[model samples]
Target: MNAPAIDARKWMPYPSAGGAPTTLYCLPHAGAGASTYLPWRKELQPDVDVVPLQPPGREMRMRDEPFENLTPLLNDLLAAMDGVWQEPFALFGHSLGALVAFELARRLSAGEGPRPAHLIVSGRRAPQHPSRLPWIRMADDPMLLEIVRRLGGTPDEILDDEQMRQTVLTLMRADLGVDQTYRYRPDPPLDVPITVLSGSTDSHVTMAELEPWAECGSAGVDIRLVPGGHFFVVTQRETVLRRVRHCLVGSP
Candidate 1:
């Protein structure tokens, strides 16, 4: 059977000059749409095209139910990105999106498509590292609320509203399931270079967890600490953009 179709019309593009040799595909964190990267697109050099992936369950596709697992979601995303691989491309993803970017790189390497020239992961630990917290699959309402409270991304309005809270909480639970249930199988390091970014104050991920990214690729690994907490991308936009531009266009 064929995989389900993803609605690509939801994706928004921040196009660049025609002569650029590379495209940077940015993926959003869980519950986030492509709008997250719309601001960064302008900050990048004119030669770098920024394409943000808009997954189901958000924005224009808010009516569609979110995916309960990563496998199906990734399949849909790869399909949505099908014909847009016109140039040497790189990927930048934050938090949950970082995991998606990593997995997508693995898939592209195994598939017939052009492999990404670089992978930029932000606000997430390496896949090989074990999570420190207990799996949240069995959490009750109070427990889930505590987790969400500590995580600090969900807005207060959503937390207070019954309808919005249910919608977001359901999506969060499924996304956390995908993250917790995942097990990294040993594979040879990727040929493409990897650059990992994390916030200095992110309580969830330790330095040890971030270091293991070096093991994922054979070419080279660069890890940097930025300001702010898990949502540092929002707080440190210019610095993040500078580092990303340097990685993609600068030395190997």
Candidate 2:
């Protein structure tokens, strides 16, 4: 199959130092830019390409209106990937991005696009589980910030700036809306394997919440619990990346 061309400006592809045979698409959490995963470029082995999805209203597409409705936004993402997916690849998503990856995987499995070799879903609960958190994204800035502070992800300095805070808040709200408004449409279990990871202490998703992810695929689901809270991927990055590398390469 011919490789689909990916527009460089739309999606950030961190090529391995050497020509890698596989690609790992990294989806960022709500309100984040592609650059959030830029550091992973240096963290992983050169043989694994890391591509971060960049939605509109941030980074290179700053002027473009952000996606409020998840359907069209997800379809657009599937289109972009279909255009450039010619090699073996896997997907890793955190928080809201986890849902995006799940939905995208569903789309790919339904269409001509390629299904991921392995799926790594971190932080977010399984799709079958209903979210219990209030609509914090719609809350006032002070209240929203309070919720975000507890969950952890955005930096303290960025939260301190009024201008940046509002800008980021808008993006975050839209991103969260994607999660809040989502209604799961059940599909058959995917043939691809899945590796589920979560923080041992994360209040956002309990072990029960994470279990449904296993039902999403036919392959045996391997679950890994790391130390820390929701954003443990930051405090425990090397550990996270090591697992990601394992999923991508099928070896530790």
Best by lDDT: 1
- Highest TM-score scorer: 2
Evaluated against the true structure, the overall lDDT of model 1 is: 0.80
lDDT for each residue of candidate 2 in 1-252, tens digit (9 for 90 to 100): 986654544755343344677777878888877888888877775757777778787877778788876798876676665566746788888988888888877777777587788788899899888667678556887777777677678889998999988888888778777888888877888787888889999989899999888889987788889998998888899999888887777567
- TM-scores for the candidates: 0.90, 0.90
135-223 per-residue lDDT for model 1 (tens digits): 77889767877787788778888889998887777777766767777778888888889999999999988898998999999989999
Candidate 2 lDDT (Cα, 0 to 1): 0.79
lDDT of 1 at 32: 74
Each prediction's Cα lDDT score?
A: 0.80, 0.79
* Cα distance off (Å), candidate 1, residue 13: 6.8
Least lDDT summed over 10 consecutive residues: which range in candidate 2? 9-18
